[model samples]
Target: MQTYEIWDSEYRFMTIVWDNAPIGSGALCTLCLQQLGWKKSTVYNAIRKMCEKGLIQNENATVRVLVPREQVQREESDAFLRRTFSGSLPGFLNAFLSGRTLSEKEAEELKKLIDAHRKEG
Candidate 1:
């Protein structure tokens, strides 16, 4: 598995590419300018950096994602849990739910998911 550490700006840039992939590089620049307020050079620089990180590909002036967004999200979530909660899912959930109430339906759904994933032994 290839783990990528994407910063906030880089993730934003990748989100754009993921949403509209196989887009022309010039069009990407225009989208970045309109959405992110970035210049053409900034868009090109970000593309080059992402390509170097194996997160995206720019081929024949068309851009596409090399790594799917879900993989990066999963990796980022795992890393956050490990760093902030010492890899304890309960600890992370407790902190996340502090002062926040889940809807009854949402709670029930979460319970069902936990039950489905529970250990048998």
Candidate 2:
């Protein structure tokens, strides 16, 4: 899988694309203008940069993501956790949950996900 690193500004732009894609490029540009207050040139610049990076595809004036949102999110999340938490998920969770109470449903869902992963691995 191809992974791309997105800076904070670019992530905002990409989030819009991820949320509203397989949309017409013109439509996406319009949304960017309305939602993000971007001009056409700014939107086109971002689109071209992302397209060159293989993060998105613009063909026939239609825009679609080349990389799925989950994949990019996972990669970015993993990188962040590794860098900030020394690659220790338990450590990261401990820090994240410090003085915090998770709801039963949230805990159950997390447990289920962990169990499924364990079983799969």
Candidate 3:
């Protein structure tokens, strides 16, 4: 899998693009200004950077995501969990659920997912 590295600034920029992609560049710039407190230069710089990195494209003043948001998020989550928990899913889950409570529905859904994966494996 060809996962690209996204720095914090780039991630923030890509989030906006992913959320409003296939959007007019002008409208994207306006949204960034309102949501991110970014200047025109900042938005343009991020646009150029992501374009060069193959994360997005600017064609005829329209912005489009070259990589889907789900792919990026999955890659980022896997990388983070591996790095932080030495590739241990239980360790990662323990840390993630620490000091937090899941709703009954969420707990049930998670249990079902675990059971399904276990059966598949």
Candidate 4:
């Protein structure tokens, strides 16, 4: 399996691209500058590096996603589960919600999500 690891800066950059893709490189520079305080050169460098990494595409000076945001989120969460909780969802949840009280709605929503993703034998 290919790793979809991204640094914090790259992840922030990718979130922007995911939100507003097929955006002109110049427009991207503007948005990055406004939102991330990144200059044009910084934006261009990110575009170049991410393009080389097959995470995004730059065609006709317009940028688009090559990897969907959900895929990256899933990979990132899976990696976290592996690294921090030894891939144990229950363990992770136990630690995360140790002192927190879940509302009925929240508990029901989590149950629904678990049911939806559960594998059928």
Candidate 5:
């Protein structure tokens, strides 16, 4: 899978697109102004950059996401794990859970997920 690096501002912009896609460019600009406090040029510039990165498409004055949200999230998570924990899931989990308590339901769900993905070996 290919992953594009997205900055915080771009990610926030993408979130709006992902939520209300196939939106008119003018509408998108309005949304950016309302939600992000961004100006028209800033919205257009980010859109152009994202288009160049193949993360979104602008056609007929309409904007839409070329990349799905899940893919970007997976890529971000994988990169974080690799960079922070040397790709060790256990290490990452340990650090993430430190001083944090999971609810019973949350713990059960995680346990089920781990069981389902456990190695056959």
Candidate 6:
């Protein structure tokens, strides 16, 4: 998969935009200030940078998402899985659940998800 590398701060900024897209740039700045405590300059800077990255678009002083949130999550999750667990899902799950316990309901949900994927693939 091609990398759509986004920094942590940029991801946070995008989260707000995703939550309230087709938003005016000024409205976006206000939300960033209220939620992320970012100034207008900072908001505009991110808008400019992400627009150039094709992650977002800002036209006519309005901002919109080009990349959906789920796509970014998938890309980041895949990268992390490869880099940290050598693309091993079981290895990742083993480490993640080492000191934890799942309730019956949780386990059933996971089983259903895995079963569903197995059927799909």
C-alpha TM-scores of all predictions: 0.59, 0.57, 0.58, 0.58, 0.59, 0.58
Q: Which of the predicted structures, 1 or 3, would earn the higher TM-score when compared with the native?
A: 1
Measured on C-alpha atoms, candidate 1 has an lDDT of 0.85
The superposed Cα distance between candidate 2 and the true structure at residue 4, in angstroms, equals 1.7
Clashes of each: 0, 0, 0, 0, 0, 0
Clash pairs detected, candidate 1: none
lDDT of each: 0.85, 0.83, 0.83, 0.84, 0.84, 0.84
lDDT of 1 by residue, 1-121 (tens): 7567887788898899999998999999999999999999999999999999888989999998889987774235454335467778887687777834678899999998888888542
Flag clash pairs in model 4.
none
In candidate 4, what are the lDDT values of residues 11-47, reduced to their tens digit?
Answer: 8999999999989999999999999999999999999
Worst 10 residues of 4 by lDDT: 73-82
Clashes of 6: 0
Cα lDDT, model 6, residue 29: 91
- Backbone clash pairs for candidate 3 read none
- Tell me which residue pairs clash in candidate 6: none
Candidate 5 per-residue lDDT, tens place, 68-92, comes to 9876642354443354677788877
Compose the digit string of candidate 6's lDDT tens values, residues 1-121. Answer: 4447787788898999999999999999999999999999999999999999898999899998888876674235454334467768887787787834678899999999999999999
- Backbone steric clashes in candidate 5, count: 0
The root-mean-square deviation over C-alpha atoms between each candidate and the true structure, in angstroms, is: 10.5, 11.2, 10.7, 11.0, 10.8, 10.7
Worst 10 residues of 5 by lDDT: 73-82
How big is the positional error of residue 82 in model 6, measured in Å on the Cα after superposition?
A: 19
Candidate 4 C-alpha error for residue 121, in Å: 55
TM-score of 1: 0.59
